[model samples]
Target: MTNYNAVFAATFAAGAGVMGMAQTADAQHAGHNNGMSDFDVYASSEYGFCDAKKIASVWGQSIWEGKMTLANKVRAGLTDLADADIASAEGVRCDWSEAELTYADATQLASYWGNSIEEAKSKVADLMSGMGHKRFVETFADAMADQTEGDEYDVGGNFETYVASSYGYCDAKKIASVWGQSILDGKLTIASKVSAGLTDLADADIASATSVSCDWSEAELSYDDAQRLADFWGNSVEEAKSKVATRMSEIGHKRFVEAFDYVLR
Candidate 1:
């Protein structure tokens, strides 16, 4: 049999048909178990699992980061530099968990093409289909980038405030310089400042500095930034230069420039 039933499965999926037994409407098929239940299988429904669950599974880990994970579901639509970072972290893949299984055709292949050509093609066509052998990679992204651009997250209530207070007064643009999404909590100001100079550094050098010198900080403009502003405010040009020179040597010239900009801003 050509499994014309898979055609039936397709029509059935358009609305409310499911394959194999599952707990929810069609989560098991999607590969994202919302709840911690074996019964909470991937929804196999053509509709729900294909989009929602699949979206959740692959993106679940990637889209999730910083304080957003601490917020309520459907609350934080998506977050800042974390959003872009999640995308950059993504490796090239055939499809998400919700996508149709491939075959020589085996639909479920954790690794490269399996045993036989037929085995390689053994995929779940009803879930997705094509003329014959082909790889289905629709987008090269992992999040709703255009829809949820910038660091101004969509979380409701105190979520934003909580993230800001715990993290700092900075935003996504500040984070992208050194991938500052993981930098929530106490060192917020410092972390954001450390990544400051990296705007002009090469990607590799920036990454290196970020990894090694990540602990630098001005601490809410009260330390280096405040002191510099004060120096330039009521001192002779020589005095100011001397002060700036000292700070630069202490924190490096690039970092000093970054801190000065942030302080003045």
Candidate 2:
């Protein structure tokens, strides 16, 4: 009634203008610091103003030296630096981003690699380019857990070759956990649990069964029993074995003696 359409258009135009100015300011600020743009610094996530400022400062000091691809990696929590590092970098009045591996993950990774974080990060960058962050972390963690003595064993090379020749990280980790690091490192030529007709299960299932020393291959349960065990107790084949064994033992001397005899045999 009161030229509402015109009013809406004006309001929209004014909002757009304000947004344009803000973006311009951000771009200018980014240019003054480095070749980074406002989009580069803040477009990755929904970070607040202070967080954006902190990320910008950190990127300028630490991550700017690396490839632009590394910005997403930093955002993904792969960098050793954290919020604290951002604060420290800001306080130092430094021109370069002094991003280093200062976080707990860095420490764990460094210890696993038996090298400093800087050295580990170089390898990690390579792994990240191909395997991605999650796969890289899982593969490295598997390798580390299996490693007994080594400063480093050309893990990047090993991972590349392994993935190319065989399956991906999850399968590789499962094999490595069962067969040992020697299999992955090429000390041992070939091993196959799967080839032997072993039941292929999730890593959690295998881990749980193995923890309780359950032989999944030989253990047999009805579908209902397995489902109940899985859903109620969160039991793997191995975990269910003890419970089943106890129940069988108790029931064998009672009405289910024939069934127990068959099971025992």
Give a tens-digit lDDT track for model 1, residues 1-265.
0111233233333442211111122322332334322122111111221232223333442111111221222233332322333234233222221232211113223224344433333342222322111113222112112222222222211122222222222221133225422222112333333345433332233334332221112122222333456665676544554565455334433345455564443
RMSD of every candidate to native, in Å, equals 21.2, 22.7
Q: Report lDDT (CA) for all predictions.
A: 0.28, 0.33
- In terms of lDDT, model 2 sits at 0.33
Clashing pairs in 2: 61-96, 61-97, 62-97
Off by over 4 Å in 2: 1-156, 182-265
Per-residue error at 85 for model 1, in Å?
18
Q: How many backbone clashes does candidate 2 have?
A: 3
Q: Candidate 1 overall Cα lDDT vs. reference?
A: 0.28
